[model samples]
Target: MKRILIILQKEFIQIFRNKTILPIIFVLPIVQLLILANAATQEMKSIRLAIVDSDHSPESRSLINAFSHSKFYTHIPVEGGVNVSIEQIDFGKADAVILIPKGFGEYLIEGTPVNVQLMLNAINITSAALTHSYTSGIIQNFASSIGMETINVTSSKPSIRHWYNPELNYKLYMVPGILVVLVTIVGMFLTAINIVREKELGTIEQVNVTPIKPYQFIVGKLVPFWIIALIELSFGLIIAKIVFNLTIVGSIPLLFGFAALYLIVALGLGLILSTSASNQQQVMFMVFFFMIVFLMLSGLFTPTESMPQWAVLFNKINPLYYFMKVNRMLILKGSEFSNLWDSFVAISIIALLTIFVAIKRYHKSV
Candidate 1:
């Protein structure tokens, strides 16, 4: 027991004295929380809305005014055909393009329906859809207003209610996902290379030659990193709550429990990598590659259900996917273990398997 404690003390002191790693462990998570949370918003605001006015008449001017008056849109005039404005939208020069046909005013006066083309950049599907829906509502209101003034006719009623996110605030949706990303990056990148770094510095050989058992060495090495990772996790969640005004609609204790399980899986996977690889570079490359692949498929940025069936199959093997789901479920859905047990069991099995393989590999190498 004393020897194990001594190993822990030695490992902790060494890690604490490493100036390069402390900043990354303590400073980077907060920085990413601040910068990414600010940039990764879902709310569509001041979108560049361009107009092609072929009619060039009072009604066209009215249509332009309709778009300009809306808080969501920033209207810009395009001096060409609808196609030209659409190209601008395609190239990301504009978010949306509204076109008024040549006979817009004449047709309105003649009681003939005039066609208006709305071209939107669907790259950001949520924002583009909202912009189109809001623009359509404005146009429908204008049409009804014109009908009431120029003709006596019943207008089609328009009613809108946004679901889930009533305010459509991007921060609310992104905060949970951002926290998942930070956890994965730190876990996969830092943890995987821990032992490999010792090997590079010749300390792994020194430890192997010592009286310390593999279990003692492994536990001692992992304890500090595990604590550091959890600390970063806590910092991220606290910032999410205080800075972004995010809520923990789910059980906070349950969330941390699942997080603990997920961390074991992360650390185990890293142990496996470090055991198999002889040097730090190989560990870094492999860990980075896996982290990228997992993060991309984890639905941190996109919905997993929206992916293709085959891609969803790949997501099943991804530990980060389960972590992402658990984080969001706890933060947004208020989920308990019953809602996340299947994922928990799978990750637990994986963790055990990796740890077993890692120990075996380390034994063979030593």
Candidate 2:
């Protein structure tokens, strides 16, 4: 224990003494939290709504006015042609295009079903879905106001409610995922880069020649980084609350406990990769490879259910997949331990396996 403490002190000194790493460790995570938490949002703001009004009638104008008055959309002026509206979409000046057909006023006056065309940029499916939904609601509401009764198959009108996040704020979903990203960066990149730096500087040989056992050396290196990563998580959470109004509705202890375990898994991977690789570039390349691949499969921005069956099966082996799930579940849903047992078990098993592999693979090149 005393030897490990001495090594821990040495690592901290080395970390603080380095100018480049000091700012990265102490400053970078907070900035990422502030920027990325807002940037990764799923909500659409001020959707550009384009109108190709060939109708040129009171009803067409009224429908356009309803859309203009709605908070979710911004009307973009376009010339009179469906092709013109498509041009607006192509030029990135509009998100959705509304075609007020020539017969729209006649259809409305005859109490016939008026068919208005809506075209959307469906590149981002979530944004498109929302834009479609908001616009459809405005059209429906306007129709209802003008006494256009529609027939339904069922008498039951369901009042759908969004629990946990009533406002459907995207930041609430993204902040936790972004927090996972920050923690992963601290635990994986810094640990890997720090250890590889020592190797490159020829300082690792001095420590390796000592009588210190592998576990002692590995623990010494990991303990300091582990604490620093937790500190990073804390700072990120604080910023999340202050800037995004994010609330942790679940047990804080549970979230932290899972974080501690997940950090072990992340650090172990970095430590092993550092020990295996010969240089910083190798370490960084490997980090980018794993980070992108794991994050893509981790269901951060997209749902894993939407993936192919084999891809979903592969994610079961991914540590970030488990951690991301648990964090969102605990923070947003206020889920209990019972609900998260499967993920907790998977993380623990991965942590133990990664730690064992990392410790076993580390060498002083004896």
Candidate 3:
């Protein structure tokens, strides 16, 4: 324990003495949180709308007026007709085009059914989906205001209650996710790079020649970083609360407690990668591969349920997947400790497996 403390002291000095490392560890994460927390959103506003009406009647004008009045749309100018509007969409000037068919006002006047065509740019699926939903909703409200009779007499309107996120703010979801990613960046990349830098500088041989055991050396290397990451997380939580109005409904201690275990696995993985590589560049390429794969499979931006069965099975071993899931549940839903027992158990197993392998792989002679 004494030897480990000495090593820990040396590591902290090395980290803080370097001016570049300090900012990378602390500043970058906050910047990313501020930027990405706001940027990665499911909400769509100020849709670029184009209307091409063939009838040009009062009903058609009323439909166009409805779109113009709504907060979701901004109508852009079109020189020609529907073809011109379609060209605007193709040229990236419009997001949606509403084509009011001929005789639309006549059908409405004669009490007959009429249909309007809606065309949307589906390149961004979420934006497209929201635009369609909002546009359809406005159209339906207009139709109802005009006293259009519904065909279904028995259909009942269902009330929807969005629990935990009533305003559906996207930042609430992204802040926690970004926090997890920041911890991962600091823990994994720093551990791997620090050790590998020592190896490249030929300083590792000096340490290996000393009386330090592999387990002791590994613990000494990881413990300081574990504490530093926790401090970073606390700082991030405070920033999130101030900037995005984030709330932690679940136990803060539980979240950090699980994070400590999760960092064990992350740091161990970094150590194993560092031991395998001859230089920092090789370690970087390897880290990049693993990190990209982990981020994509972690259900951060996408829903894991929508994935195929094979991909879902593959994510069972992914540490980020479990961490992301648990963090969101704790922060958003205020899930209890009992509800997250499986995640805690899974991270424990992962920590044990990875740390065991890292220790066994680490040699005394470097």
Q: What is the lDDT of every predicted structure here?
A: 0.77, 0.85, 0.85
Runs with alpha carbons beyond 4 Å of true place in candidate 1:
48-70, 75-126, 133-163, 364-366
- In angstroms, the error of model 1 at 51 is 9.2
Residue runs of model 3 more than 4 Å from their true location after superposition: 49-71, 75-119, 135-163
**Per-residue lDDT for 295 in model 2?**
95
After TM-score superposition, what is the CA distance of residue 285 in candidate 2 from its true location, in Å?
Answer: 1.9
- TM-score for every candidate vs. truth? 0.75, 0.80, 0.79
Question: Candidate 3, residues 224-317: lDDT per residue as tens digits?
Answer: 8788788888888889999988999899899998899999988888889999988999999988888889999899999999999987998889
Candidate closest to the true structure, highest TM-score: 2
Q: What is the lDDT of residue 192 in candidate 1?
A: 71
What TM-score does model 1 achieve against the real structure? 0.75
Clashing pairs in 3: none
Tell me how far the alpha carbon of residue 343 in candidate 3 is from the true structure, in angstroms, after superposition: 1.2
Task: Report the poorest 10 consecutive residues by lDDT, candidate 1.
Answer: 148-157
Candidate 2 lDDT at 71 equals 75
Count: clashes, candidate 1: 2
lDDT of 1: 0.77
The residue-by-residue lDDT of candidate 1 on 1-366, one tens digit each, is 677788778777877898888888777777888888788766778989888888888987987887788788887768777778888877888998777778889988898766677777888788877776677667777887788233211222244555555666777777887887777667766767878888888877777877777766766666667777788889888887788888888888888777777877787778878877878889988888877888889987888999999889987778889989888878887777887899889888777776677667676243
